[model samples]
Target: MTMSSVEDSTQAPFVAPEIVTVGELLRRDLHIPDYQRPYKWTVRNVAQLIDDVDTFRTYGQYRLGTLILHRDARGNLNIVDGQQRFTTFCLIALYLAKHTSADVPDTSAAALPDVGLEISKANVQDNYTYVSESFGSRRGDLSHWAEFFLDSCEVVVLTVNHIDEAFQMFDSQNTRGRALYPTDLLKAFHIREMSLEHASPQLRLAMVRLWEEIPPESIHQLFSDYLYKIKRWANGQDVPQQGFSSEHVELFKGIKEADPSNEKNRWARPFLYAKNYTDDYTQENSTLIRYGALSGVEYPFQIDHPVLNGETFFLMVRHYYDLGLRCGLFQDDAGAIFDVLPELKPVLDLLDAHRRMPTHQLVRNLFDCLVLYYVDRFGEQSLDRAALMMARYAMAPRVQSKQVRRAMVNNYALGRSSARPPSTNLFQELRLATRPQEILRRVLASPELNGYPELHCLFTTEEGARR
Candidate 1:
């Protein structure tokens, strides 16, 4: 198909454009068409693209064709629509550039720091850009296949003006297969500029305190899902709405109190508890717990974010620590489990001997312990027993296969999970006592019991879990 101009009304004929590798674009010119939505790919996509390319020699569908870029003198290229693919290619290129280079300084070119990508200003592209723009970077793992693709794939670019025209051409020229979502496009816009810093450490750190506890491995899905939902909401689409109803203003309010200086008791206040209230940070405060729970799904950036206020996001941090506790890495003395199961006392002494062991070491230990506990308590059907196990754990089922738990745990212990906490109130004490029976009792006994709110309201009522 031909490249059209937003500036002109002419629908031109298709013309083959000059082919270029991502390296050339980095060295010279690239601009996203006004019509080109935004970069949306996450690290997962980046990793996957690399893997796909890596399989090219064997897997027939691996090699992606030349990407068309409409460049402008301002160094801005009207992506006209291959933005996601283009962005992904650039990230892969960066990965290849970094991993293959012997010089450590050159490796900085592939630097994919953990931060949000905001593509708003000129000269926005920078070192971190490639990583945030591509799914490969978001996914955080570059397989051998991806490495191969990063090392080899080249992009073909076409230049023109009229952002809409380019975008329309991009939309129509799809001979490949599936069409990407507009949400994906919007995401690409930011993804493309991943190298630039989007938020300050304050904001980023606040975000971390809010949702940092989410497993690093699942961050991509959480981010993608939230961003997609928000975009759909913005477009008046019928995307499923979870609960946050508050507009952006209210959400920010929650974060404002999240600061350490603000005194209003907040979900994040607990996090400061961790820092030992150092003189500089002790003044911080966050209202996440009070407002977050009250706001429900109407939460700002209601998506599964990494942090909120200054506290570790509830679900993620709680889950991670819970997992650790389950594995005997943490323990409770008086039946009260501290968040991380403090490494002190009798438990610490016992674990000290095995501290150097791998993640699988802990996971298997936990698994064996849990199984034995269950078997002793209620035999093999313990999972089905009336004992509210899910509530006790404050997490969902092991939906994410634990096959890699060993490796994942090792990464976590090594501080490599890029882990963070969950949003404020996401795992408040409410989650800790989530057993259906407990909920039923709470509902029947207390006005505020609400008993799991919507999802299990029926379970607490005459209706059961199915209801």
Candidate 2:
């Protein structure tokens, strides 16, 4: 829970870190910055904290963890890190003050902090409910335990004036509890990147709200299952067996739009033009008569296109998240596909109804990634034909082999196979293709489908239509 610090001799006098009890720390005005990740501690996390406090009540002093604070010009202490632990402590204080006979300070007598994000608010409500029930069930006089909790539980507080220094410390500190996810690290990185543009606080808050609205698990899956695989496979690289991790984050961190060199670079022209046009059109035409038709014009985003760093990165995630929903990757009902592309229904329905063995599921993932990539590149142009092509390409391995592994899937993606000459790598083809026919023209070798009559019929009908 503790971190090592070095003192600077040339700079202004260093503010010494202080060790304060939970009660003492709660007396200060604490704030959670909008750019911080949503509170994600679960019920088990709360219960564990309570148990730890009870276990060490008689040990004189129990250090909770380190809290990094960035003190703003107005003297408000913004939580740069450890907001999760700090928030849990606040909940405990509130529960004890209302339900127990603990001599809690008057400063701690307050309502729960209003959390703006839905995910954080939900966790706070759940954790509070657990705290109330757990505290109420405790036996005998509980005032002493409460007193020990408030007075004995300690945390090392490190206060800094600059946000960058606070985050640097956060990155270096040894986290004692839940580990930060790769998504969390990405959020922090993009938020810092946005800061360089001096983005307005309201705009920053809006961006965070947009991010927090989506379920965290969905975002993780979107990156790990679809985006990561598509990026690697399109480049003719083997996808890691372990899927996406922190090492792969750099793939998403492309050129910063604000960088002078990149802004002037020829490669950034299309992205910059799209962003500017979208912004200008929305601003000018939003209240006009044609608003309905033109107001929601978005930055043209492609899955293979270079990711613009900062705000656009958030937009890119949202863009694909909505796409995933429409494609029925996150939902159970296939109705969404009917709404957007009725042509994909038969293939998607057949896949959904089939037995989902591990290998089968891998093929399913491959199909989903291809459909997503095709749509991303060409929109609805020849979408039905593109979908059939993707299905044939993705499902070939599943039908040809009874036991398909990760390597087999990867090889099939790269057009490497032993049974026949290598087929066209559809992903690579899509990356190079400007027109749908360029991809649709590539012929697929039909797989031996002895047991899968439905698939055989699907391929036969598609081939017949082509002829």
Candidate 3:
């Protein structure tokens, strides 16, 4: 009877032991086992590995370590442990292979260089032997894994009776030294299994670029020191960091800390405002709508929103951007924001007046003014008296959340009756205005501006009276 290639069930048990490059390992579809935990390697960890290899010639010789793999029922080498280290090594290898000429064909074997040439040749050779013996008898198909491990790398494979042992081994290997963050572990899971290998680079690159812009030092410091502050705040205790949920706040902190300060680092903070830019391709669709809104220079779409996703962030950014543009709010770039500082001075002063007020309130008030200015300019009804009173009451201590308080100020500016409940009179007044700027000037010069305890005069009148 014709028999299969390996019909010798009773023949001497043979194992294929061999060395391989990372390429082959990857080609085999070799990956962490289902029972294996996610990749917990942080950006710092990755950065260090690359930095070590780049800076120290022999860095690869000593062998950072190895991983043990066993053939699963599917005949695949399921990583039992050392997945993080292995993955990191593979990443570095891929980067090096791309950056260097090691993978080029038609080159002499003598010219092909080892990744860890700085390591003693003897140590490198020993590393090769260690990897060779660990793969059992399947050496022929392991050229890729071998090249990476033996060339100043070391890995060992062993058969295990159960998956629990593998997990314990994994935990033990990764528990010490630099602590791996849970968020970082989550990142690995998202990157390896959750995301498609052939995913679009545009989205990923944009996320990475934006994340990189957040000052690394600031992220690290916030995680290290201020993250816990939110916990206390959430628990109703006084804490430094405010406005974030305790659990999420701490999680963000941990991730921020896990990110590397090293130059070789990859990955970045998840984009908090990624949706902002992605949602609108043009500056006109942005929050400010006008190019030269805040800076008065009409800088095209200079708005910077924390890269977040979905409609909430989209609308939020849109509203804020529009308000800032209309009100000419300047955050940075002194030359751009400098001119409007005077107009925003009262808003800033009112915000500073209350120590206990929430941040959203302050920002809201600022935006309300912008909306008022916009509505007055474009709306059929000029909200004269209401606009005047709105500006007047905005000077009050409690006028935070400029948006919520906007209607109030708009109603008051018309001056139908400051205390009157909601009525069509306010809307009608908004319609009848001839000059809205006149109302704006009156609001700016009203008793609220002059009498505001915190207000300070920048310029003097002809008679030297408070202007």
Candidate 4:
């Protein structure tokens, strides 16, 4: 459905909510939409649900949770939220019907639908196997438990006629229960934005698949460790002590191309032109550029650029993910540093060998962030010199102080420490520099070289060799 129809539905009156038992809820036809994320609930989640049913069976009617469904024009109930819980419940029902003599209806087991997506299918099989094994062990108690689960467990069913309202309600309701990561909310928001652009269903499904391919933890680290810090530091703001959260999602949500105001937004012209040119070039050159150098042509994306909403946001994420892998930012090994900046091998080796303390780790993170920002802005031009400059700047704070805290790193970056003069925000300098030599030429006050003997030798020796 198009977004206009969904947007208009917000003005319509709300439908009355209904409370239904698990059996009654399962009897109705349910559908899983393509835009929804894959089933991610593990065995622990399944066991918890089973345990909750057993613990609260004698406590009168127990509420399971809420389900927000969209009733389409064809009268199908498309699950907008609670797909994981709903699918798990279906597996439980099927297991009970097979293993117990409980008075469960035949239709409950018949409602189990086949999932098409590979990730969801694998999870479904794994969860079902766990359910079957759990049911087999509790053979004597299965009958009564099945009866209580089918009849006593209830859910608050809030069904809306429009897709947008369903998602809005989903977002509103999810705040209290198992908290969703900020990335999850971004996924949902962009899907809605894509619908507003009238993106084809095939295109939407492809984008979702591309997102699901990345491990969720890697994505979390990408934001928490690198992107979030660089964005805040470059803007001369202190990084949040509590880490990234839902409040900061707007940082990544930029102009929507479909908005009418974009036509008059002069600032958006360069981004839109680049996007259009890339699309046309790739399509036209798909056959001719099969091998060699031309095959790797990609949209020019910078870490500090304005994020285009919907599909481009997803592509930007993929670009950074590949970049992180190539740079070895996610792991302890700095061997990959040679690939881009071979000149930094001695410096990296010194840091890797001697910088093993927890405080040293903070300095390493600072070094990585600087190199990432440099490559993002200036490409490979003068990369070795730039990396050395960043290394010297990031490492000096650790050597100057006996005990380093997070605030010390922040102070060094912003030039607030007593050891350095004020007005030396390194990231801001990198952002404003027009050429590589500008960064290479900038200097910092040297900390006492005797504080760390090996690092001292490396720095002084490198300087001697350069001269």
Alpha-carbon error at 456 in model 3, in Å? 26
Q: Write the per-residue lDDT of candidate 2 for residues 126-213, one digit (tens) a residue.
A: 9999988887877465677788888999999999865556665665563323266567667777776676666676666667767877
280-387: candidate 3 lDDT, tens digit per residue: 444445555455443212212211212222222223323434444444332333324323324344544544344235533432342343333435244423343333
Tell me each candidate's TM-score: 0.29, 0.87, 0.27, 0.88
Superposition error at 419 for model 2 (Å): 4.2
Identify the candidate with maximal lDDT. Answer: 2
List where candidate 4 sits over 4 angstroms from the true fold: 1-14, 103-116, 176-178, 289-296, 332-357, 421-423, 449-458, 463-467
How high is the lDDT of residue 126 in model 3? 46
State in Å the error of residue 232, model 1. Answer: 20
What's the ranking of the predictions by TM-score, best on top? 4, 2, 1, 3
Summed backbone clashes in each candidate are 81, 0, 60, 0
The candidate, 1 or 4, that scores higher on TM-score is: 4
Local accuracy by lDDT, each model: 0.36, 0.76, 0.36, 0.75
Instruction: Give the clashing residue pairs of candidate 4, or none.
Output: none
